[model samples]
Target: KVDQSVVLAGVKMKNPVVVASGTFGFGREYGQFYNLNELGGICCKGLTLHRREGNPSPRIAETPMGILNSVGLQNPGVDAFIAEELPELRTHDLAIIANISGNTPEEYGIMCEKLSAAGVDMIEVNISCPNVKAGGLAYGTKPELAAEVTRMAKAHSTVPVMVKLSPNVTDITEIARAVADAGADALSLINTLRGMRIDVNTHRPILKMNTGGLSGPAVLPVAVRMVWEVANAVDLPILGMGGVAKGADAAQLMLAGASAVAVGTACFADPYAPVKVRDELAALAEMQGISKVSDFTGAVKPW
Candidate 1:
């Protein structure tokens, strides 16, 4: 077997395959399908300072090879997560990366402070969730806002902090480097592309929110490119995402410089997406004579 163990920001994951936030639903919906412990770790659903009921109905609308959502960071609040979800999650024997979001830098710090004291392995600071306006675009679309939020989270977070980025920015790599320089231990990208679907008959957006984050196979290529760009911009490790749905897809990201990857929309296509990706990566590593997946990170041949 290849040396697949790659640590991102101090937390050791058996491999790079992880369940992306929002898609895996805090590992609850997938429990009936597979052993949650079998996976590397889960970037749980976005957690806000307070519990959110989520956006209106029709939050998810399927497309040709992608999905759109405006779910709005719904969660049981941090305390509930600690009291109920975290306790059960702890029993599962896997890294628990709490993904937190906030409307302001102060709120983000407070949330990170709460999770840090909980001893979570890592905190994925969600700075870009385009489905909502207040907290979503405020940090993601601006380099300064991104860095401010990232620095604030890192200041209060004892655990390593990961900044989740959006793809809507004009220059993604610039923002990525800014966040990294702001004290982010690592970064994960590219969050869903800013997209919308329209119901021609009704002349309105298909999603109840009218606009949503687009994720799936359609966005994989862009994600791969962003991974390479971000890798070239910063020395810290990176976790890439977008529309990875196969072993080769994961391999491609690795080759492009992803230290690890998080599976989001792809999970909607297959409950065992991460497992299959892991197996696929294992096979690819053996075939390519890669001793460790990290060896392939940023190995993209020049064009």
Candidate 2:
């Protein structure tokens, strides 16, 4: 029998399939479709220090191979999540990764402390949010800013900390190395590529935010490339994501160097996407005569 279990940065998962943040929404909605314990982990919706109303209407739009969203991080504050959501999530057998976004390093530190004390298995820091004190530049775009956030989160959190890297940057490895040096235990990459669409008839942008992050099969190649680059550059374990819809796609990322993979946009089309990917991945492992799924990580040949 193939061992589907994977150990990512000291956290053991039953499998390598995890649902990405902002798409899984605490796993309550998708729980109706299948058993939440079937997958490896769940990165909960992005949380801030306070509740956010999010952007105006028409924040989501359909693109050719994916979707663009500027949901503006609409979520209940961290306090509410700890009180109302974490308890229910604890009942599941999988690892619970809390994804947090903040406008400042101090804010990230505070949330990390709160979430870690609340008993999350790990913390996924979302540095894609604009640093309000830095003239609105994304923390993930600059190595110093990214390191600052990582350091602060590391200082405050008791559990493992994973920094999510943005694909908008010119060199993702620089940010990855910076975070690794700053004490990040793991990394998740290719948060979302910046993209936009316009209505030819109305002469207006489709999303209310004018532009938003693009996610879906459209970004798979870029995600794989970045994951491969960062994995080669840094020694930290990676939780790779972007446009993964099938077991083959997940295997591609694993072979590229990701210790684990996350299913995103595809979940919108099919709530069973994560479980399906997990089962198919196990089948593929068995067919390959591989006794363990974890052996797929960084197994790609560069020729």
Candidate 3:
């Protein structure tokens, strides 16, 4: 059998297919569908300082080739996650990556410190989250703000930090370089691009939040491009994600320069996407005469 195991930022994973945060729901919900241990890692739903009720009705809107959502980082708070979720999640025998978001740098540090103490395999800092201190501007949209959050998380977390980048930025490479320079051990790219939907009849915005993050097949090309750009710009390992719905899509991201690929909206459509992706990736690697899946990373040729 081909070796699918990979070492990302010092953490050994069984494979390079991770379930994106927000889609997996602490691993328990999806565990009912399949064996959670069959995949590389699970990035738990985005966590916050306190419980969030999320936005009002119609938080999600369907687009032609994608969906838009403004879930507002809804979660049961970090304390509860650590108290109740972590113990059960540990039973899965897979790398558990905590994805944390904050309104300020201090909040990010606090969450990272707690997750690190809890012994998570890694911490994925969601810098795409809005910084309340900066008037609701996403931290990842600015290179300086992204670097600041990366510094804070790296300082407080004992585990390796992977700064998740926002595709809404003018120059993603600049942000990637900033975060890498700020001591981020890894990176995850192309968080949902900003988008919206409107009601032609009522002449109003369809979603309550009006603006939402877009994800699905439509963003795959953008994700690959951004992953390639960031990969070329930084030496950090990348957890590339955008619109990965199949094993071929995962392979495309890996070839573009992702050490691993995270399944986001695909899970909503196919609960077994993580396992299927893992299997498909292995099949593709063998078909390509590759024994080690890591060999596919950044294998894209310009010629």
Candidate 4:
């Protein structure tokens, strides 16, 4: 069997197929369906400082070959996560990654402080989310703001800290390097691209939110290119996602320089996508004569 173990940010994972944030709720919901230990890690849903009711009705809109979501960083707040969700989540016995968001830098810091004490394996700051319309996209698109936020989070976090980046920026590498310089342990890309869909009958926005973040197979190629660029620019470990739907799709992201692959939209269709990806990666590694999947990281064949 080809070796798939990866030691990322001091977290030794069995493989590199982690469930994306927002896609997988705090383990309890999906745990009933699959064995959580089978996967590498869990990037739980976007958590805020306090419990959020979330967006109005119709938070998710289906489009041709894609999905648009405005989840609005809804959560039971950090305390509830630790007091309630974390206790049950710790039962999974796998590396746990918390994806966090807030309305401002101070809020992000507070969340980091609370989650740090909760003994999470790592924290992924969800700076790319656009649905909240506050401190979400503001921190992600600008290089300076992204770095500042990364710096503050790293300051407050005791464990590994990763900044989830947005693809809507003109230069992703610039922001990647900034985050790395600000003491980020790793980076993840690309969060959902900004997209909007209109209603044919009413001619208004389909969702009451008006706009949402787009993700799925449609954004995979762009995510690959961004991963390739960021990996070359920064030496920090990179987690890649956008439209990973299959084993080969996961492999492609790894070859593009992502140290690991995240399953997002793919999970929507097949709750078993992560399992399938994990198996496919192992099989492909053997077929390619690669003893370890990390050996192919950033090996995007330059044609």
State TM-scores per candidate: 0.97, 0.97, 0.96, 0.97
| Candidate 3 lDDT (Cα, 0 to 1) | 0.88
Candidate 2: C-alpha lDDT: 0.91
Candidate 4 global CA lDDT score = 0.89
lDDT, residue 233, candidate 1: 80
Native RMSD of candidate 1 (Å): 1.2
lDDT of 2 at 249: 93
Distance (Å) between predicted and true CA of 177, model 2? 0.9
Among all candidates shown, the one with the greatest lDDT: 2
Model 1 ranges with Cα > 4 A deviation: none
Kindly report which residue stretches of model 4 are placed more than 4 angstroms away from their true locations once superposed: none
Residue ranges of candidate 3 with Cα displaced over 4 Å = 130-137
Winner on TM-score (1 vs 4): 4
Where does candidate 2 have its weakest 10-residue lDDT segment?
A: 128-137
Clashing pairs in 1: 257-298
Full candidate order by TM-score, most accurate first: 4, 2, 1, 3
Each prediction's Cα lDDT score? Answer: 0.86, 0.91, 0.88, 0.89
Enumerate residue pairs that collide in model 2. none
lDDT of 2 at 213: 86
For residues 76-175, write the lDDT of model 4, one tens digit per residue. Answer: 9888888998988888767899999888888889989999998899999988988887778889988888888888898899989999999989999989
